[model samples]
Target chain A: MKKITLLTLSFTLSLSLILLTTGCAPDAKSHTGGAESLDSGLPSENIDATSILGAESGIAQAARPDGINPETDVDYSILSTETVYFNYDSFSIRSSERAKLEKIAKWLTDNSGKRLMVSGHTDTRGTLEYNRGLGERRALAIREYLVGLGIAQDRIFTISYGEERPADTGDNENAHSLNRRAMPGVITK
Target chain B: MRSQYDLNSMTKKLYTVLFAASLGALLSSSLFAIEVEVSGTKKIAVQISAFQGADAALAQKIVTEDLRRTLMIDPVVSQGSYSVAASVSGGSLNGKLTDTARGSEVFSRTYSGELRKMAHEFSDDILESLTQVKGFSTSRVAFISGTQGAKELYTMDIDGANIKRLTSDKSISANPSWSADGSSIAYMSYRSGYPDVYVIKLAQGIRTRVAGFPGINSGPVFSPDGQQLALTLSKDGNPEIYTISTSGGSPTRLTRTRGTETSPSWSPDGKQIIFNSDERGSNQLFTIASAGGEPIRITTPGTYSAEPCWSPDGSKIAYSTRTGGGFCVWVYDIATRVAKQVSPGLAEDPSWTCNSRHLVYSNNGSLYLLDTVTKQSARLDNGLTNCTEPAISR
Candidate 1:
């Protein structure tokens, strides 16, 4: 217990040091100026520093318009096992992913407030136009299967990113297999 | 607080901006004519003599580079079968092409106006008269080039000179289809964060989203009359072929299928469209009337084929088909229903010139113009990498 507390204390100090160094830089100070400095006279004693630090870092990382780092922001661990993979030049869902689609359907039923989005992707094997159509078909297939499994159709949205977004950037068969997938995400908005 | 430090920084930024602006001005005005040479062994031999008058050497050099890059003609110093004797008088250029072997004049034409325009006109006229084939010399091809996330549209002359960037959306903008009259280009862009078909007028630089249905709106091909566009949209549950008025309205669905359909190309009469559909398992070429009807599968014996383009004369349909060697350009004779391989390497998206004798396609990242008569393929190196989807405009 003592070791954990000490580690947490050091981590908090380091985070504060980083925030001060980055947030109080000359250019940042010049832009933000006196109003913010005057308002932030003292750190609140009752607040949780970790959550404050997380919120501060999130604000700092708002460079992306979506405010979510495409690489790491979304916790797709829930849908990682439910990912539907497709064959090369084909968008039909393989027979193996049907069980996972059932699980996803049940999960959607449990979490009625959450909306789902299926984004289709493809490998870099064919023409852009063909790949786009293939990607959309893959997404539609997944949506239909989910609908068949009792998921509400109106709660799900589909978008085909084509070969624009790839899970694996390699050109080999293994990478291509990983790239031809339909990813699941929650629509917060 | 207007501190002296702030004032000094502002002045420094202003000076830097001015310096960059002046440098850009200088580059645009002086170095607009890109100096590049194309060399090949199997080239037609010709001699370009020195011209006399203002900007004469520049004009001669531009003409030589232009003709040399075609990969069809070679400029020599002496002992040439054909000779191009040119001279500048006042603001116009007087040029003549003569057959040295027969000692007869092939043609003579006078080009007035800018020196660059004169050089281009002379090259076009010389090529057309000598070879009896339409010259792509002065033509321009708009293509898509950039990294994956930053793909945009760009246009360049056939000689790989005078590159002009058409779209700066900094997003994915591709599949540029030029209108018959070259007044506008219809392309698919994701600037609104969704793939939508947008038409951009070249003269006024106005972009209007012609088709933005619920789902995919791509592969926008203009009709021969430029009154309508045939594209692929997925609003009806699956990717299907649809045709919409160029002015924008409700899109009439053409192909109602459970499989994928894309890459629509119009015939010369604009009565039918040849597109790729995977309804029978593998992507293959299919033809259907523009109004809508049953789609007839055109590819037989081959399971994989895509990117079909019908010739201007409506004689052949060119597409990329995977053979034992690899994916290559194959021209299918509509009359006999026989397919013959035209391009040797991995080539796709064949767009024909107005002449119908030559077709342009992208091999890997470089664009090449293939001469159907001689079976010769020449690389059009515009110094841009990842260039694909070429559309020729008159």
Candidate 2:
């Protein structure tokens, strides 16, 4: 319990540090006066520091184009799952995804006798047919990890929604990164 | 935001050697008079003439060289059955212009006195050979040529004579792709500030806008049956291939993508279309079912390729590839996936005749007729006639 709390605190701190360093980066470099800074690496914050917002704010941008509604923000808990993803115009997962797959296998190990559906999603880009293929590859990658953990491929049905159901709708890259990630769902017994 | 480019490259060289007819009409246009010859028969022997003045021998040599170059551009010699350019010492101009319309008219340039004289004789023999199947001797090339930096569509004989303007507009008019029957020509013009497809009848001078989208509506190819026309349009916010009924109506989208698609070439049967696309991270040739489905790629390598025209027999496909710092014309054999390089210089925008034997294209400042079977070629006219797109009719 203590370890989880500590990790959560550090994750928040890292994000805040990232925002502070990036947000203030442009102002810090104003030494070259009167020039508009062109650095695109800056982080944009939606609400105040003390305010908490929805865990999944990616797709909410369609309704709240102005950004997160801090006062009305509802926090839906997000249970982290380390599902792997594929590369652009490719279906094969890379070596970098091995770590994520191991973590996912451990999750299935801890929660034994549980049913799960490995749903996959791709970011909105490329052709519809191509993206669908991409989603299937992503799902298959996750399924392959579970199968390596001795889980039957048939036991875990996979579904691919190629960029059709994006977790985020904001045009910004931060939202897109959050949406590119894959999450897990434990089916009821 | 979308664009497509395709290239057809032959892995192995085929038909590496070719030659043109040997006759006085073998060349056309210029001083030594080699460039003035056109439309040769089985073999037209071009005679190198000594200049009236200095360096008579050198001038004769110069004319011979230019004669070969001119023969390289003549459609009849460049693309037809077979022709060879061999210089001769002497010959008389016996060809006469029987077609009265050949008088200084754009179409008459195809009937230049010297060219007509040669065309008349060879066309007779060629007509005899043509009658075996049907000769294209009298057939002319309708193309878009420019002068004073402004272009207008024109038609002339394969000899590059009797050039006449078809569309006299202040704006640019180009790519005069003729229909199979030789009765009408479809081309692109910017008279409306945006490129649009316009079809003009030969004898009646009836001009009709076949396609005009809000954006680019150009590169129209008449189906073999002439019932449908395939074209490229950017109306959907990006360039993509589309088709419409020839009689005129709404268009049917053939491709949906982020990549721009243009330069649509229909198959001889009109059941398929080979197009240029960058869908695979680079510009390459791709074919799609005429009704629209998955596209099968044909060309494997090359970053720049475009403007594909299907052979009349549907046995092969001709396209342009960026080579040697300029686009060179090549033909791809569909069944074997083999390509044969035809054009010796920068060439693009290939359009074929009903015979499917020769291809008309443009390089540098003039149009050229490239014979896939013969190595012969010919320059269209002078620099005043900046020919880019050449379409020949049966």
Candidate 3:
């Protein structure tokens, strides 16, 4: 009995020692990783927190009604909103933009024969390839949302322009926010 | 007797555990081993002697500028550690590099081409002789230079000379991929009122429609072997990376993820591809076999990384990551899994020079070179505005 007890005690102590060493290993790795991040000069957080003002100003301009006027030849009011704007580096539909997407969904339902193309775009801030991906996500998010609202998936097509097409030419935050959007266009064929 | 046997078995087990633990430590420590030296940022000095014959001044001036743009060397007025002498006669030029410090001839070669092209060749040869590194002087940078509304494909010499507009499609053109031989460039344009991938053979200026799928056809990159092109297409639903023969056959899908995937860069071995995907909600780097398989995410948490270009040595992946205020060029060491930002400014679209020591990226409508070891960024002087999407040949 004594021998068995001793064995259990030794095993527990050994297990704890191994656990402690293994736990400490990750800490050391994370410490070096933290140092590398600092050394890379890419501060994880915003360097100039004031840059938010520029972005917010851009968002404010996004509220303006321009860039997507209905063609005088067209008779339908299919698009209540010509474009759906997204936040920086995000594809999640803003709560405020949900209603506009619903209207687009209703219009698509009304015109079953018509096809809509959602072309995604991004601000000039991120890498071109990433922005293209982000743009696609934005367009997909809208497509998925419209599909959820009973719009046929076949009626909707999506494309991501990345940063190739920007609605605003300025480099300021206002322009960037305006540029990061998904424009729903009527496609023939 | 039974107790004695039990004790012996326990001892054997303990020895086995000890052996395994030590082996694991040994394996892991070596696996994570990385040697990153913060090397000298100082430029190597080289003297460009006046060319002896025809196109002498032009040849001398371009070679001097070419070396200066390296961000690794400077042009000295007199003799330095290295000196280059060239003689241009007719369309042929002979250039020689001498190591002044050792008073020994390094290399001598004759190149036959245009006046400017011959000078570029000499600059590249001299650079290779001095540093044992391939020079980008003779390489061309294909990029998009225009407003967001109006964009076109433009090619310029690495020294920012010989600005040639390759496309007049009067539509948006983005993501120019240079061929391995530097004879052609492939890019996606909207000339057909939709995105279509086109290859422009530089010498003959012949444009071939390689891909015009039903949906998105963008981010076309030539494979290392030059036989296949990896690009992003949304024809099947979401944007995913696919590989198609440059000769225009059906594309074989590489990534099956529902997430958007773009910017596929080939590994030097042509066995794997590194591309950007938002599988985790934000953009990150992922690698998949060129033949198609499960992808392995390469980047760590904290930043949005994209546009990955694998190094020629396959030791690192140079990409642009979203930093605090802007994007910066960073290199992710494959062995250590450690990322080091090499550019200090807002830079994007990084492509490695053939030497793999330096990368050229665009910052604020201009292109710059960043040395991975020294972490020095120098602007490439082409004097063009809104130059982005820089693709370096070799």
Please list the C-alpha lDDT of all candidates, in the order they appear: 0.77, 0.55, 0.76
RMSD of 1: 26.3
Off by over 4 Å in 3: A1-82, A109-114, A169-177, A187-189, B1-39, B99-108
lDDT of 1 at B290: 94
Candidate by candidate, in order, the iRMS in Å equals 27.5, 21.9, 11.3
lDDT of 1 at B76: 91
> Using lDDT as the measure, which candidate wins?
1
Clash pairs (backbone) in predicted model 3: A58-A174
Which candidate would rank higher by lDDT, 2 or 3? 3
Best by TM-score: 3
- Candidate 2 TM-score, C-alpha based: 0.49
When just chain B is superposed on the true chain B, each candidate scores a TM-score of 0.85, 0.68, 0.86
TM-score of chain A of each: 0.59, 0.50, 0.63
Expressed as tens digits, the lDDT of each residue in B1-394 for candidate 3 is 9998988999899999999999999887766552211135667778888789977988999999888777667899896778889998998999998888999898889999798888888888877776677887778888888876668999888877888888887777889988888888999887766678988877897899898775578899898888989998766655688999988879998876546678899999999998887655567788888987778767543557888999988888898878777787888888777777788767888999888998888888888877777777778777678888888888
Q: How far is candidate 3 from the true structure (C-alpha RMSD, Å)?
A: 12.1
Better of 1 and 3 by DockQ: 3
DockQ of each: 0.07, 0.01, 0.11
Off by over 4 Å in 1: A1-78, B1-43, B89-91, B323-326
